[model samples]
Target: MHAFKRAVAPVLTFALALAIEPALAGSSETGSGGADRLVGGNGPDQIEALGGNDVVRSLAGEDRVNAGTGNDTVDGGADADSIDGGDGDDRLQGGPGNDRIVEERFGDDRIWGGEGDDLIKANRGNDQIWGGPGNDTIYGGPGKNVVDCGDGDDVLYYQRAGTARRSTGCERKVREDSTIQGRVCGQGGTDDADALRGTSSGDVCRAGGGNDDIEGAGGSDRMFGEDGNDRVFGRFGNDVMYGGTGDDELQGGRGADRIFGGEGADHLVGGYGRDRLVGGPGDDRLEPGWGEHGEIVDCGPGKDLAVIGPGDRTRGCEGVRRGG
Candidate 1:
């Protein structure tokens, strides 16, 4: 039983960039057929279409193809391809590439092979495909596909919540003194993912997911690998993490950090952050974060879910266990 409804792209509200595609916004196109070469102009292919080996080229600017109802072939040259599969599944590509493909209802589209292949996909209710960093693919099937194959040479990104998706264009607006404000709000300041860098080095963090292997570079940062099998680092900050439902490696760089194995069998670590770590219900290991967060200690799951340690006033898990 699949019930992942379609993602209604947020009206692009404050659209900073309306990527304009050459000639395709209004044009001479086809409905569905064999082979017709499409060059320039706006097209929903609102009707007339080319048969066998048809070539729809979208050169320069932002372009769209309603590639309606047919086993059609598309070439979005030097631009992003927004294709809505009406009936038959289609093949779409981003030429000179760095292309974006928005797959909607009605097609089991096979979108691939681009220079900069970035795909945001959702199936005809229950479709399957993957994104490509190096021959990547997106099977955004059985629901709303939210996957990002970040800077890497990988394939097939794992899906997650709408909160996990990244923003671009006007979607990402950063102010002076490092203030980020837009569709995705920052952590008070700009400590959230919207900004390239996080807040503090010795700060605990949960970098949102897609299909990535993270390293906590310089600071003693903590990381949580939720949703997919990943590799993480605690460069120099103290951190904690939860490898929720995936095979993961939680490595602390310089400081000590804690880790929790929620579902998947994994490897827990205290990379650099001097921290406490734990595993839920699987074959797992433990490690620590970078430096230290002042005598951090752990005593497993208390009757309540609170974790208070050594001389700390916080009395949730450790201090007030016999709830009365």
Candidate 2:
């Protein structure tokens, strides 16, 4: 009876192992320290390819993929995923669903936040990021990088004093430099109408084409409304406003401000400080005495009008319609 029981136990153990083999086999994989390729099956997978140029494809389901220390390519396919490219020039594609992608320092990377609202944090390198068709948030690390927030209202946090060439469908924050200067849209074009707001430090904000609304929140600010009918608001501190082209509106909110309405019919309002309003080309309207101190209005060319509030001063502005 003891011999029969031992033989039966061995047979049962073999059968049990065969039964569980299909469920445990080939669902997940990992790579070694050499260049390798790891692919995940259609389940919540965890894949790690350590220390080599690797390719990791998370084919479906919620996946967490880590490509460790190599020039790797990681694609997070569908569903929510988290991918990290550790210490190499990597290309990360967050395909289809909302994903979190992290890039390690010391290599130029290309990241695509594809579909859904994704968060992409690029490490210290000259990176190129595309926030494709979703309200994504991107952090451009301490390198000269290019980010295209494709469609949707995306937010980009960029380096201080770093130059940004262009932005479409995005609200960008230009981190304050050592000089406490924040510059945005200063040397580029915009595809859509942008609403630009500045920080407490001195800022230079530029609006390129498209009907834009720009506000200088605090500190001494400089605003340029280049092309398109725009509204420039200087909220605080001594400010300078330039309405480059198209019918535009300029408001000097506080502090001593200088306002320029360049080309096209414009409306200039000096809000609450000693201000200078200049109307350059085309029919324009300049308002004064909307501030604590008296304002000076210069009607540069074309049929321009000066609207005077109480206690306002004007020069070269006459025979034009006047109002409060």
Candidate 3:
């Protein structure tokens, strides 16, 4: 642990160069309070750069390096090393070794684990990470992130809040639930299931081809369940929902919503307001919200069941179940 004082990065760069030059390789070194440039040797060494925007590099061997504070750049040059970027916006590199890199700061950082299996934990801020080769594990903190695990099996753990995470080349991705804002889209063209949600403002969601789940939270939203068995919820405001080409369940929660159960045996619930429920080409079950009136239920094709109320227009439904 080290006490850190914030210094201007531009001033520290000039002061560090005049104060200390590059040390001999393979030797243990410690930096001054100002921003310092510390270079490690071919053999194992310990480098601790306390305070300021320092640049530390472990050229070879198993090394331990810690950049205490300020915007720092640290590189684990070769072999296995443990590197920690203590605070501020940092760029960390684990170059060609099984390394453990930790960014415990609140800044937008960039990390690259270049070759060999590595473990990286990016704490707070919108981070960009690349796990280059070998099996890797990456943990992203709060903020929008772009993670590319290039070549090899990798696992990424992220959050599903308002932060947008774009991940590629990782074999497995696990998301922790948080409140969402705006639009959320599913992975199209793959049979991978996605959980999508919307915010208070009008949002759009397209669940493509997988067994998906969606929740439209508040506002007038447009939701599409493109394929597979899907469940869609329009929680508030006037919403438009489509269960496209699958056995789906749609709940229209409040407002004058339009819901369509397209091409499967589906269940539709019109939960209040003057709603329009269309069951297209399936043995569907349609039910209106409690104490609803002036609704339209059109069950097109197949033996469909509809629970209608007063002033509710119903056509193309084979069976009718009276509401209480």
Candidate 4:
């Protein structure tokens, strides 16, 4: 009986050791990560999360937060704030007037700027973003990217390649031989749209509500003039556009393109490259491209007269041709 008791003694001791360890290790341990909530009230503050999936939050003082490298969920609680993410997948966003959220190329990212002038960036990887209710400028480089401006005026700049043929002419490189090429035939391509649409310059550009002047600057793009007298400029690429309400101007520059002047007194101008032009509703003004090969004329639907000819690649309008 004594030998059997002795044999069981060690096991009992081990079990007791394990139980006491929880009591000792969990309390009175410095930086033990027991601090799940920290309130930095009304003073400039910083919260650093040591490697682990952590929830770190900062309250309404001018604050800076670093969710130290591991999968993290961070919030810039109220007031003006700035947030940074380090090594590991992170989700970070700001709240209230004027905030900035920046993410490095360590993971797939999503960022939001909640009201006021906000700056949000995914410096790397495929990123998704939204700028809420303010005038904003968004940019993406070398990755599959998407950005949406929920309300208010916004601007988006995408990557573009400029093609211009030049010569050391004593008379100068005639601004006449510049033409734009969109895509190579028979090659698989991606459907990338330019959000460079809608009117800016505080000139009421409601998505489908106010009279907005819209421009799709780069990439194969699309646009619709929802209301008011709107002007639409499609700077480059294979584009398709529509003018929905009020009098509108549609400029489809370079590429095999299509344009529609919907309702109101509308004007449509087809620029260089193969194009399809359609004037919809009202007394529509349909103009083919004018000027020398590389030059442009500021002819909106009004004041400037245009002549439409047989579709793309047709040398109908008076302009300098390449090598002419």
**Top candidate by lDDT:** 3
Please give each candidate's TM-score: 0.32, 0.47, 0.48, 0.38
Is 3 or 4 the stronger prediction by TM-score?
3
What TM-score should be assigned to candidate 3? 0.48
Off by over 4 Å in 2: 1-27, 174-324
With a 3 Å backbone cut-off (N, CA, C), the pairs that clash in candidate 4 are 198-214, 199-213, 211-227
Better of 1 and 3 by TM-score: 3
* Candidate 4, RMSD to the unseen true structure: 24.0
- Residues 1-324 of candidate 2 have per-residue lDDT tens digits of 223223332332232232211222225667889987677777667888899988777766767788899988777777657788889888788877666677856788878777866667786888777778776767677777767777776767676344255334566554422222223534434745776778888888877777776778668988988988887877658999999989997877647999999999998877557888898888887875334545678888887778775567666764454444
Could you tell which candidate, 1 or 4, scores higher by TM-score?
4
Q: For model 2, what is the C-alpha lDDT against the true structure?
A: 0.71
lDDT of model number 3: 0.76
Worst lDDT window (10 residues) for model 2?
A: 17-26
Q: How do the residues 1-324 of candidate 3 rate in per-residue lDDT, one tens digit apiece?
A: 001111222333343344334445678889896878788777777899899888887777777788888888887777767788888888788888767778866888878887876777787888878888887768787678778877887878688443333677889886644332323642322355667877778888887777777778668988998888887878667999999888997877657899999999998877645789999998998976532587889999999999876778899999997753
Which sections of candidate 1 miss by over 4 Å? 1-36, 41-55, 125-130, 134-139, 143-324
Give the per-residue Cα lDDT of candidate 1 at 241: 56
- Models sorted by lDDT, best on top: 3, 2, 4, 1
> Please, what is the whole-model Cα lDDT of each candidate in the order they appear?
0.42, 0.71, 0.76, 0.49
Query: Each candidate's root-mean-square deviation in Å?
Result: 19.5, 21.0, 21.0, 24.0
Q: State in Å the error of residue 16, model 4.
A: 36
